[model samples]
Target: MTYSTENTLLYVEDLSVSYGDKTVIKDINFVEKDVIRTGNVTGQVIAFVGRSGRGKSTLFRALTGLVKPSSGKVLIADTTTGIDNDAKVVNEGDIGFVDQKYTLFRNKTVSQALMFALRNKEITKEEKEVKIKEYLHQWGLEKVKDQYPNELSGGQRQRTAIIEQIFCSGHYMVLDEPFSGLDVGNIQDVKDAFNLMTASHEFNTIIYSTHDIELAVELADSIYVIGYPSIEGKLADYGTIVKHIDMKEIGLAWKDFGLDHMEVVKQIKAAMLSS
Candidate 1:
């Protein structure tokens, strides 16, 4: 659960992403979420939390190659490609991203949809079946795997979408607002899916974005807060970031990973103080 001594798995430094001339975010570092501006992201669960227009989705797009950043680079390992359009740095299966809204083939059954994702992976039929069953059980999608998207409830749809992403065997996974449309039971399922993926597989990193700060605290190992600077209150907004750090320095770390790491909390507090 800890990686105090390991190689850098993913690194993003001085990442400045913008939409045209309008700068949405600058000097944004997604290393360990808010804890650092530029560092290594490995074996880290980073939750990007902010207001509606703080560019959380924008950050996700840039990381996944859906949106090109005006500047900066995302260095990924393994097979997930498109980290750099100009030069190859990583493969195409190392990173997986879950869209904020549910996106599935309404016409295709759950099994069909998952099979579509596995088409190019070169996995054996038995291996694929095993993986599908494992994910279905892990996400509680066993009964509904034979149903279509429209036939399932909102939570079930979300689970299907998440399972599809997790089965990609990516080291880094990004889920945008993954808890938005889920009931209590499904929320627990999604949380369990995360735990199992990180524990059983070497799926080390996850970057989940949400407006729910409380949920982020519960699910994230590191938190990233992005507040947009308005026309008249840029200085004050910067001050708020400072205040956030000050508050966290007084021992406000999230405890969902378990209450056993009291020393981890102290270390996080110390790191915040030094920063």
Candidate 2:
């Protein structure tokens, strides 16, 4: 394989999001926001972190066209043809957005849902089945293919949602609290799945948002500490901190100390600065 040194993807300039008069993210800008640049290729993972009211989700929605931004332009290169509409222009199979409150269609069977996605991408029937099987097996959902969302456990449901998006050839995934409700084991499973997806795919990136600082430090290649109504945050490069700090200080674990782990905090901060 040849390596190129001039690849650039997904450029956002002075991006901001607003709800009527209330601004979520303000003057958010990055030359290569969540982008990887090679000679002719680029991939990147940007993890967004902030309090409940912060514009983390709002920024994501604006970039993906679900929400409109008050100012700035989001330039997604390498996948789409134009960046004019802001809502319409995007890379094909680029953004796989998973909502916090479960977005998968409960009526559709797992296989049917995945097939629907594949079909939308112009994949043939035979190819769709093959891909669905592959995803089901890899995600440990082979047994649940016929099960509905209501029948599965919370972890299984989340995995199903993630798998549906991935099978459609989505390279960039915007996971809104991907670990919404799950046990420690399930959380690990989600992480493993995410790792596997990134490892096997090309031009893949993830923008995961969560209030859990530990989750951010563990899952994100880079971390963004966002404040409310502001389109900016403190960004720490990948693995920059190894120690975890006070979740309360970061607005996580609110009033509960049980969710607080000092050792994890120490590791996160250490990892952040080390890298």
Candidate 3:
């Protein structure tokens, strides 16, 4: 289906980020995107892909409203109709961010970490138990609830982190290089879990940054190939969206793409190179 304004869940308009005088990314632009699907669910899933140190993580931070953009705005849908994004800016609560390291206190069990997230909820101990247990069961995390972060597998730890963020924050989630350190087996497990949650509408939108092109093509509804531009004065600038491929419009099966998926992967890599 053609993408309209109403489906524009999160909008990034003329956004750029910088450390000081050195610009990390600039001219990050995206067109109106079409409907994206995962399993039985239809929502927005955007992927930022590029080489390491290409400012993908920084962009993720900006998207979550944790870091202010050097200029421009990240507009979100605050109404049923128009974007109303002229000067609109989203705050932290409108988005959820899970870091690449999967923030955890030393020696903290998954249950303990979750409880820490709820410390500000003002709910009683019993009430917190009920909520945490409900989500633990929902996320298939009951088996590892008692284990500390160091004791869990990579996939288990990642899943626990995601569950903790959703338990702590609201709907939208942004993951910074979530698949970076996982083994091949664990990578597939994390991918499967994400598909399951997204299919269930547990996350209204999921934005993640990765260097894994093949996986991004398979999982993301929209893939933004970020890279450092080599333009005259733009040298040394950070990454920006050079290619915006809406996977939903590609007409291949979701996550089940075979040979066709590789073709798209090659194209995304080509864009990465050109960016």
* Global lDDT of each candidate: 0.62, 0.62, 0.75
Clash count (model 1, backbone only): 9
Say which candidate scores most in TM-score.
3
128-197, model 3: which lDDT tens digit per residue? 9999998788767799899888788888888888877776665478898888889998887777667766
Residue-by-residue lDDT tens digits, candidate 1, 1-275: 21333334566656667676777666665433223212433245666666566577877777777776677777665434434222234334456888887589979999889887787788798888888887777677889888998899877887777767766746678889988867888788777767765564343777787755556666665565666444453332220111122223334333344453444444434433432
lDDT at residue 103 of model 2 (Cα atoms)? 65
Q: State the lDDT at 258 in candidate 3.
A: 85
TM-score of model 1 (CA atoms)? 0.75
- Compared with the true structure, the alpha-carbon lDDT of candidate 3 equals 0.75
- Which regions of candidate 3 deviate over 4 angstroms? 1-5, 31-40, 79-88, 122-127, 230-236, 253-255
lDDT of 2 by residue, 138-178 (tens): 88999989987788888888888887777664566778888
In angstroms, give how far residue 56 of model 3 lies from its true place.
Answer: 0.6
Worst 10 residues of 2 by lDDT: 236-245
Instruction: Look at candidate 3 and give me any clashing residue pairs.
Output: 24-238
- The parts of candidate 1 lying over 4 Å away from their true place are 1-5, 32-43, 79-94, 229-275
